[model samples]
Target: MDISPTLIGFIGFGILLVFLAFRMTIGYGMLALGFVGFLIVAGWNDALGLLQNVPFHTMFDYDMAILPLFVVMGFFCYYSGISEDLYYTVHRWIGQIRGGMAMATVGACAGFAAVSGSGMATAATMATVALPEMRKYGYADSLATGCIAAGGTIGSLIPPSIAMIIYCVITEQSVGTMFIAGFIPGIM
Candidate 1:
C-alpha cells in the first residue's frame, strides 16, 4: 500500500490534535508525530533504522544537556534551601512597609529569574519556598500568592532567559543584543 504525503500530513495533524487534547507531554507528542511522519515519508524500514540511531545521538547530545541541567538546578534551588534564603533576605530587607513584602517578593523573584528559565517552574518553586512564610506573617492570601505568581512570570521575560538566548543563537544574532531588546519589552 502507498500513502500520499498530503494525506499523511493531514493524518499527522489529526493525531497531533488528539494528543494535545489528551494532554500528552508536548515533547513526547512531537516525537511521536515526527516518527510517524518519517515513516510515512521514507517508509517504515528507513524510519525504524533512523530511530535506532537517532535516540542514542539525541540523548548524548551536549547542546541539549543544558536543558536537564537547568531543570535540576531549579529543583535543587527549591529543595536545598537556597530559595528559602533568598525569600527571607528579601523579606527581612523590605517586608515592613505597606506592600513592601509583596515588592520584596517581586524583587527576589526577579533575582532568581536570573538563574531559572521556565516561568511555570519558577512560580511553582517560589510558591513552595515563599508562601508559607508569607502566610505566617499575616500577609493577605491574595496579595502574597498573586505577587509570587507574577514574580515567577518574570523568569520568562528576564535576560539570560533560555528562550531568548536560544532565539538569538538560532537567528545568528548576538545574545547581548537580544537581551537588551527584550529588556524594554519585558518591563513594559
Candidate 2:
C-alpha cells in the first residue's frame, strides 16, 4: 500500500512527541524514528546501504572535522580558567550597575562564543561559571538562567560558530564570508 509523505510525516511527528513525553533523548528518538521510516520507505537493502555509507562519508568530511576541534577547544578553555577570567573581566567592568550582572553575563558569553562556537558548550560552561555568582548576589533564578540561556545563543552567530560551519557546508557557501557577515548581528 502506498502512503503519502504527509501522512508519514504526521505519524512520525506524533511518535516523536510521544518519545519526548517519555523522556527519551531527542537525538536518539529522531535517529530511531528516521531509521525506521527510511527502512519502511526504501526497503531493507537500501536502508542497510544508507546506514553503512552515511557514517563513513560524514566522518571523513573535511568540514565536519572542525566540529570536534571546536568542542575540544571549548573544553580546554573551560579547564584552563579562560572562561572564568572572561566572566570576571566583564563582571568587573560592569558589575556595579543595577542589572549589570546580566550584561556581564552576555559580554562574557560573547567573548566565549568567539572561541567556543557551540551554544550547548557555551551555555554549560557559563552556567557553571556564572550561575553561582548570580545566586550569591541574590539574582532571581529566572533572570540568572534566562540571561545565560540568551547569551549562549550568541555562540551560534559569532565567528567560528559551529552552526555557521554546518550551514556553509550544507549550502556550499564561504565559511569566512558567513562568519564575517555574522559579526555585527551577533554582537548586537
Candidate 3:
C-alpha cells in the first residue's frame, strides 16, 4: 500500500493541534505520535509489539531512576531548611549596600543554586525569601524583581547543578571538575 502525502500532512496537523491545545507533556505527545505513526505505517501487529515492549524498556531503564533521586534530593534539601540557612547566612554578611538587599538576593540565589537542580526552584526560593524584605527596605521593584529573576539562572550554571551533573554522567567526566567549572560561570 502507498503512503499518501495528504494522510501524512493530516496526521502531522492533528498532532500539532493536540499539542498546542492541551499543552501536553512533550514525552507523552511524542510517544502518542510515534505509536500512531507506527500503527499507520506498519499496521496493528508491529505497533502492538513495539507498544508492549517500549513501556517495559522505558520504565525499567537504568538511567531513568536518576530523575527520582535528584528530585528527592531537591525536596529533602528544601524541606530540611537548607535553603533558609543559606539565605540567612548570606543575608547576615551582605544584607547591610545601596544594593545590599539586591546583593543579598543574589547571594541567596547563588547559595540555593548549590543544592537545587531546577532553575525554577532557585528562582522561587529566592523570591519567597527576598521579595518581601526588598519591598520593605524601600528597594525599587524593578531592581528587586530583576535581580531575583536573573539570579535564577545561577541554578542551571552552578556546580552540582542538575544539568551539569547530567552532562558529566553522560560524558563520563568528573562531576567535581564540572561543578567547579560551573561556579564561576554561574556567578558571573
Q: List the residue pairs that clash in candidate 2.
A: none
> How would you encode candidate 1's per-residue C-alpha lDDT over 124-158 as one tens digit per residue?
88888777877887888998899989998898788
lDDT of 3 by residue, 20-61 (tens): 689888777878888888898799999999999978975675
**TM-score, one value per model:** 0.72, 0.84, 0.72
Question: Distance (Å) between predicted and true CA of 171, model 2?
Answer: 2.9
Sequence-dependent TM-score of model 3: 0.72
Candidate 2: tens digits of C-alpha lDDT, residues 9-107: 999999999999999999899988988989988999998898899989988988888899999999999999999999999999999999999999989
TM-score of candidate 1 relative to the true fold: 0.72
- Model 2, runs deviating above 4 Å: 15-32
> Which candidate, 2 or 3, has the higher TM-score?
2
Candidate with more favorable, higher lDDT: 2 or 3: 2
lDDT of each: 0.79, 0.93, 0.77
Candidate 3 local distance difference test against the native: 0.77
Q: How many backbone clashes does candidate 3 have?
A: 0
Q: Which stretches of candidate 3 lie over 4 Å from their true place?
A: 1-14, 22-27, 38-46, 53-63, 165-184
